[model samples]
Target: MHLAMIGVGYVGLVSGACFAEAGQTVICMDVDPQKIEGLRRGEIPIYEPGLEDFVRRNVAAGRLSFTTDLNDAVDRSQVIFICVGTPSREDGSADLHYVDEVARGIGRTMDAYKVIVNKSTVPVGTARRVRRLVSKELARRGLDLEFDVVSNPEFLREGSALHDFMQPDRTVVGVESAKARQLMAELYRYWTEKKFPLYFMDVASAEMTKYAANAFLATKITFMNEIANLCALSGANIDQVRVGIGSDSRIGDRFLFPGLGYGGSCFPKDVKALIYMGKTMGYNFNILEATNLVNQAQRHRFIFTIGSFFDHQLDGKTLALWGLAFKPNTDDIREAPALTVMERLLDLGADLRVYDPVAMLEVQKHYENYPYPERIVYAPTPEAALEGADALVINTEWDVFRQFDVSRLKNLLKAPVVFDGRNIYDPAQMKQAGIHYFYIGKPIY
Candidate 1:
């Protein structure tokens, strides 16, 4: 199959690489010539695990290419995948301008029958809207071309996107016509050998499925966070509560760990979009509203815990921050809880020395234009962050931080104080090391 991926973002790049690896000829199109040129020169724009290897391998095999010319890409492909971004608008609605532009471009350029697949996470009626835009463009050209728009949302996790794409548990495809369904099935026939299930549903349901799944996962994380907070007040341990509750067949152990609230690209945006969707329809999604509230409050509660430890006297404190990425194994810092903590600490006039495996450059770039960029110091190593600092705060649960020498940690810091946001360390070990440890959902010692 010949495929044209409209936008070269995370979803488009990963999907295009995986599809090319599956023996499909793919051209990943983007508006930025610089990004396309960078891809051509083996320079990947994003830091995703295993993505650079995939792009380079497929490009070397002549199965995948990158381009800024949308018309050329559209004219040569039988399947056009709308993999553009739908960032949240101010009102929490999905900003579909990019998707609409791609649809209009496809309608204007596609000379033959093509299968248009919506692989981006979008609102329920976006496929219908894209169909109308494409039809309108075709009418303007006075050309009657047949194209089928299929809603096929992706469910790839960020850190493990390549594996998820290559080994998806299930694929949900929404189609209106039998022809579209058959074409989609043929496109996904490669997965049938792996015995991965394919679900066929209406377009609206498929769109709703993506939002519902993320919202539910976000809700689960929020619920666990609430329970963790309550456990802290009642002198209970969340680790035990999590194990006891997750052992139930009904409640699995995924996304149940108590940590800083859910962030990154999908969860925060999808939850807000769903809430906004409900408001638009004259319905109130009360649970989701609370979920959003709880997630936001989790960050503040963590900040307050840190502040209370110092008796609200944070001025001139040199703190060692362990992580900056929203989660481990990726360099994405969007809506990262670490940033919230860093900002609040800076506001309280504390000097920060931060370290992350791969996200330091990103955070430094972000602070370049800040008012007090000099207040934020970059550390060469995690141990370097602890040097000459008053205390340590573990913001992200990176593997290196998880298995660090606790005894050395107690020796390195000016004060043997630790604030663990991700609850990565064992409390008993901290106690044995004679280190002051504070973590989420348990007694502080």
Candidate 2:
């Protein structure tokens, strides 16, 4: 199969690489010449685990290519994938300008019968909207061309995107015609070899599935956070509670660990988009609204815990912080809880020495123009981050932070104190090391 993936961002590039690896000829198209040129020169823009290797291997095999000319790709391919971004707007609805532009471009460029696939996260009616836009363009050209618009949303995690793409839980495809369905089946026949379930539904249902999945996961995380907070106030340990509850077959142990909060490109935006979708339908999604509120408050409460430990004298203190990306293994920092903690601590006039395995350069570039850039210090190593610091704060539960030797803290820090946001450390182990430890949903020790 020959396919053109429009907008070579995270979704497009990863999907294209996977398809090429699966023996399909894929052309990844983007509007930015610089990005396309960089890809052609084997420069990957984002930091996704195993992505660079996959891209390089496939590109060398001649199954993958990069281009800026959408017309050329459309003319050569039998399938066109709209893999553009749908960022949230101020009104909480998705800003579909990029999707709209790509749809119009496809309509104008496609020369033959093509399967138009919506691989981006979009609203329910976006498939029909893309169909209409393409039809209008064909009408303008006085060319009667048969085409099918299919909704095939992506369900990928940032850190393990390659794994998720290769081994998906399920593949949901929305289609209206047998022609479109057959083409989709052929395109994804490789997955069925592994016996991964493939579901085909109506366009609206498929679009709703993506939003519902993200919103539900976000709700689960928020619910656990709320339980963690209650456990803290009632002198109960949340770790025990989480294990007890998660052992139930009905409630599995996923997203149950208490942490700062949910972040990244999907959860926050999808929850808001669903809430707004309910409002437009004359219904109130109060649970999701509460979920959003709880997620935002968790971070603030974590900062409060750190401040209360110091008797509110955080000014002029040097705090060693770990984790900058929203989650580990990916450098995506959008709405990262670690950044929220850093902002609050900086606002309280505390100097920060931060370290992350992959996101330090991203954070440095993002905050380079800030008014108090000098207040933020980038550490080359976790131990370096703890050097001369009053305390250590762990935000993201990266493997390096999880496996750190607690006894070494006594030699590196001015005081052996720790604030664990992700609950990565053992309270008893810290106590044995004579280090003061504070974590969510547990009494300080």
Clashes of 2: 0
Off by over 4 Å in 1: none
> Mind giving the per-residue lDDT tens digits that candidate 1 earns over 361-432?
999988889897778889999999999898999889999999898989878999999989999989999999
lDDT of each: 0.92, 0.93
Weakest 10 consecutive residues of candidate 2 by summed lDDT: 436-445
Candidate 1: minimum summed lDDT over ten consecutive residues — where?
436-445
- In candidate 2 the C-alpha lDDT for residue 334 amounts to 85
Q: Report clashes for each candidate as comma-separated counts.
A: 0, 0
Q: What alpha-carbon RMSD in Å does predicted model 1 have with respect to the real structure?
A: 1.1
Off by over 4 Å in 2: none
- Candidate 2 pairs with clashing backbones: none
- Note each model's CA RMSD in angstroms: 1.1, 1.1
What is the clash tally of candidate 1?
A: 0
